[model samples]
Target: MEEPQGFFSTGDGCVGDTVTERCLVESKEPVSHVQLACGLCFCAFPLDGNELCVWSTKDPSYQPLILRGHRQPITAVTFGNTVSPLLICSASQDYVMLWSLDECRQKVLLASPLLSLLVDEKSKQLVAGCADGQLWVFSLVERHHYRCVTRVDLKKKRETFSRRVESRLCSLPEENRRPRAHGLEKGEDMEGSLPVLSLAPCDLSLLLSSECGCLPSESAPCLWVGSSAGLLILNLANFELEGVLRYKDFRSLSIQVAGSCAMMSKAGEQKAICLLTSMFGCQIAVLEIRLAALMRSRQDLGAGRSLSVLPRGCVLSTSPLHFRIAEEHRTPPAPQRRTVQDQPLVFHSKVRSSGYATAPHVTMFSPKTNTRNNGDSPSRRRSSHRWCVTNLHFSYSFYAGDGRWLACGLANHLSLVFRADLTGTPAVFSGHDGAVSTVCWSHDGRWLLSASLDGTPRVWSLRRAELVLCVGRDLFPKPIQSAQFYYLDAFILCSSGPELQLLKCHIDTSKDEIRRYKQKSRCRPVFRLPTAGPTEITSLSAVNDFYSYLVLTAGRDKTVEVFDLNAGRSAAVIAEAHSRPVHQICQNKGSSFTTQQYQVYNLFATTATGDGIKLWDLRTLRCERRFEGHPNHGYPCGIAFSPCGRYVASGAEDRHAYVYELGSSTFSHRLAGHTDTVAGVAFSPSAPQLATTTLDGKLQLFVAE
Candidate 1:
């Protein structure tokens, strides 16, 4: 298998990137580079007969916002700055126009046949390139109205002098108008309008989305204009010419882009601009510019710390470059182009207004006003305490404080399924793209943390019914096998990377625009735990009870690491703690009467090794005993302990839960009900009951007699 760009394979040939398609939008035309913001995607393309069109990203199989208004084929399209609301501007031969996101309406701006479009977030200015060899920068006083800062005619001096052509100045129309013949006929149209060959708007404030800068700076915004004649860079600050680098010797190699240009940001530190020119068939030309020097030149504007600097001196190249599109992307069928005749002033469509409904994917389901079989499958049973709610299977479940809230780990997301006291369906929290590996709830039941193979742990608020924070890969670029809150506050300990990591995190509520409380981040990661190797840490368990301030972790390395907060770092290390990869860990308070004395001990168990659950004394950091009745078929199946610490509970791959009396070290009951491997087992803090989640999506509650 081939690795993606920017990724490297390990000595074992394991690369970090996973190949998966999140969504697909098949169109009858070639799709431009897509930009996404505020849960929406915007793309522009020329459809049947080069009809310029704009489509908003839609849910799978959902009808997209087919925005139409451009009179001629589009040259460039881009979205507004991230801090600003959703605003899309497009430039074409028809003139410059602004399209409101979601609403299907368009407002005509300058009537000049514009070539490119860009919005400077700092000054709130709209900049465009014209086909008549002129540059126009419009200060957006409000909307639709633009007062031009300046305009420059870009016709070369040699061309003007050689032909003795008296260059006529282009007009900036005060009102909306389209060029046509003087004589009016029923079917007459304008064929003189042509697209500006090349235009690209590179914003300076886009660095806000990357967070590489500590502070926001004025992006001394500029436009890179390219034509068959040469390349010219214009300053948007005063609409002045900054520099012009042309290929006088290689004249035949410079036919500019007839469509839009693309940016490759992740492939290299330098922001490389890739454009497909009309001069060569399937040939791509890449231009890499140093924005730091440009920013330093305009440092008065928002320019953060110096970014990357390309060592190259030349800005223009004549060598043919090929940008390979993946094989999965087929060459869009080129439809027959209709003659540019009988052009109408106003473009009509099925849409009357630009208003569009929100995509259906952002849906939420709360508890019911009238309750049913609770959190169980509908066909399972109808008891009050035990209900059948769904046919969908779950891999893990946990009963929060007093057994009021039951959270189950689903596919990439998880569910906060309440007990029978509450109504409605469960609240599903989604973000991760990998299967949820482990889940833990905070002591007060306000915060719920779920770890996944997606290399991050998502923080979900049970009170808000929404996902609050995502501990991203930046904190540690390793799959989070398990994660837990240190207490109710403080930081979090996640089992990832070489061993474990401490992430500085916090959450709080803020007033929204209308003064309603909304959860937001107070801080992010402050530092990371340092380790030596690249081996994966797969399991984590920490004691938050009054019993102790200790943490236990194990994984593929077959070693158990215990971290004592009060004493600092691993208090002890048990070598060869498991024969195989450790899967799960459960920390509980256990009391044993030994030698005519009642002794309370800090104990934890690991579902590792070919043997069953192995119980260890945390105080001594030694294995107390191994319980081996349950079938050890899967990697470290789930293990749990009762709140009172009287009984030890665990689930095996054979779909059986083995409960043993800790004092006797003997099996007490063999619970068999699930159709598949029992992924997790949890005991209620207040009630004498056990909850089990299976791979077949079953959530069952078992009560102790």
Candidate 2:
């Protein structure tokens, strides 16, 4: 046989295809460095040793490319004026390089060390501190060239003197010009009017030096010097002493002045000098020149008058060399909330229905209505009642007439019946040698049917709580998997090893004997339905009506088969409907009907290998939809549809009961009070309540909103 078009070959035969294909491309390089930036601390790492990798904080695994370079380890990164084009300056200890990165590629420019670096619109400058303690001025000379200019030398001397004394009489004081015996005057106006200082290289007139450690200005005619004893402000234009600032026991390391003093420049402005000890301690001292004194000085020099400096403002001390201040602000506006208005509402019913009527001797309105409403007010009752039954692991359960009684089948071949009247203790009926697999109540509420792994079906009287009859292997000569009562005639569908046998049931109430209503010789095989490859039938449920009479069966084939019960033969099949062998099949209440209007109905639902619940439409013989959000590790063992047809509850091997909404077609929520795999789920007929039993032998009741 040619393989199905979309199916892939597997060890377990053909299955439906659901995976999508994808491809990935990788670069041929190794990653080197990683860094995180921004005020929010987002992570940015290097990929391929050349590309910048960026990823969100929440998801660090998926790294996307932000920028790629031709060379590796783009060092010296800085965020420029714009957030983009984060300026990255890299040097290989041999070549100095500059790169402007936008998003993907790094643009390399200015690959030389002699070039000066320009401060962009971001107001940040790069000052080179050489090993000789000399500062180099770097500014943009052109669009691409940065001119480097060497500024000052601290080793240069201002004046030199010879050690020869000219004359001892010349050191005499001016007040006493007459020479004394020792040739020394008492009051001395000696030291012959301080010697003039001159530059060594006269051609380098632009070069300036200070007596103490002072800063040379680019546009000022005065150089300010600072030493351990005092501060010296000297006129560069006239080579004269201008002003002296005194401080005790402190030395200055750096001086920053506002403007010139000799020339008509912006003077009288606040000048700041940063003082530092040899031990790397710093202090800031400020000097403000009076505007009146500055104006008079300019007038004395025969220069045009102008307000060189504004009035002094508040002076600050001990400011850092590179200081940054940030103002605290409020958080940004929240994003507009997005509402998922069209998402379907999932209605979940608890394991048992609350407000179930507890009246005795109540009758159902009609066989077709399936309504058992009593005159009791729904608000007057507690949602559910708690019961204590030890080791009561139930695999199947049914609620009879007006929710007055409940029957449960257990894996230990024990059956339990709980009276809703809450007046008496529950009764246990045990007879089968193997696990009881199914239980159901007759329409008239007189007989209860139970099928077991012991290959027998038993009938019990509800009032006496006693086993009435046992239909064993002698009747069908095979393992009976499921049995149900249909009004006067009981419909028993059995799995005889691998074949399906349908038998009609009859009860001789006078002798209290139950037997196969049809003669053994006349009873023939109705139809032999297909299994899940080689798996046997595991479960079955019969619909309530005639024409479209359906028998839903689950098998180890991972498929749920819907047989045409009235056709007397299994003709159509839904193959491979589940990912694995299905454990149970259940018909929704009110799903079985014969009507003139052709209404579509989701007849039955099944639970299988995966944590998935599938809905089957009987009329089309197709699997309509699936609910897939259950715990993936669990094996779904039993399923039950709520009487309201709005929700489906399932029990799994993970010891949890999962409730799924039929309208939303999704698993809504999970109930986690069970200690072992939940084996059965049954809802109250009159209200939204549920009863659940687990393999650990605990029974629980739950209410739904």
Best by lDDT: 1
| 225-265: candidate 2 lDDT, tens digit per residue | 33333333433222222333333212332433211111112
Give per-residue lDDT, candidate 1, residue 404. 61
**Per-candidate TM-score against the hidden true structure:** 0.42, 0.42
lDDT of 1: 0.49
In model 1, which regions exceed 4 Å deviation?
1-401, 420-424, 514-519, 530-534, 546-549, 566-568, 589-601
Q: Write the per-residue lDDT of candidate 1 for residues 21-101, one digit (tens) a residue.
A: 332444454435432223355555444322434443542212234456666656666676531235667666667667555
Q: How does model 1 score by TM-score?
A: 0.42
Model 1 RMSD to the real structure?
30.9
Evaluated at residue 298, the lDDT of candidate 1 is 24
lDDT per prediction? Answer: 0.49, 0.43
